[model samples]
Target: MNVYSPNLELARMVLDSQPFSMYLGARLTAFGDGGATLELDIRDELRQQNGFVHGGVLSYAADNALTFAAGTVVGPAVLTAGYSIDYLRPARGEVLRAHAQVVRPGRTRVVCRCDLFTVDSEGNQTLCAVAQGTIAVAETALPEPVE
Candidate 1:
């Protein structure tokens, strides 16, 4: 089912206002009715001592993707209820890409799933992690923070 987006531009603005996503260099590449895709570059700053991308970084990407996917159907005020991720392989690549989709959308909650991949310079993608999460529509619109 397709629903009208209250304000698509507002979604982008909200994402840009996220301090953590900005700090991590995450970019919202695509947004649609019930899905979203995001990308992040793999830089030395994002790597752990073991030289692999940090688990937290992957989790962050997954979490954001899930929320964004839900937001497509629930509106930009959606919040992540909870999420779980499984690391399938060590991440090593030039960039990271996350694809998220809403499995179910409800009046107040949405179930989402996301797949995180490592993309090489050649454009080959390797699945590194998977996530499942629930997103909830906020009770009310929150005011923007004072900077």
Candidate 2:
């Protein structure tokens, strides 16, 4: 599906401004009405003691991607209510990709599904985790930032 270009720009700007995403080296690759793709480079610091990417890292990516996907129709004011994920395999790859899509959309809440994959340097993708999340959309305008 073609991405809504404005939402894509907003997603990129949000990711770029997020301290956590910045520290994790996450990048917003694409975003549209109900979908978002986030990518992260695997680094030593992001791995568990066993050398696989950590679960927390995977969850973080999924959560943000979920929110971004919901944000496409909900605007920028959205927060995740909760999410659950199951890890299918240990992530061992050069990069991690979190692909999220809103499967159920509403005025106040949106449900999103995400698949976390590890992409090897050779570009092979292995499913590492799956997630489902509920996002709450703000029905009212958010307060402006104070100077």
Q: 26-45 in candidate 1: lDDT tens per residue?
A: 98888887899889999999
Q: What tens digits encode model 2's per-residue C-alpha lDDT throughout 1-147?
A: 423244676568777877788899999998886789999999999999999999999999999989998887667778889999999999989999999998988878999999999999899999999999999987676554342
CA RMSD of all predictions: 1.8, 3.0
Pairs that collide, model 2? none
Worst 10 residues of 1 by lDDT: 1-10
- What TM-score does each of the candidates earn? 0.92, 0.91
Give the lDDT of residue 59 in candidate 2: 96
TM-score of 1: 0.92
Best by TM-score: 1
Candidate 1 CA-lDDT value: 0.89
What count of clashes does model 2 give?
0
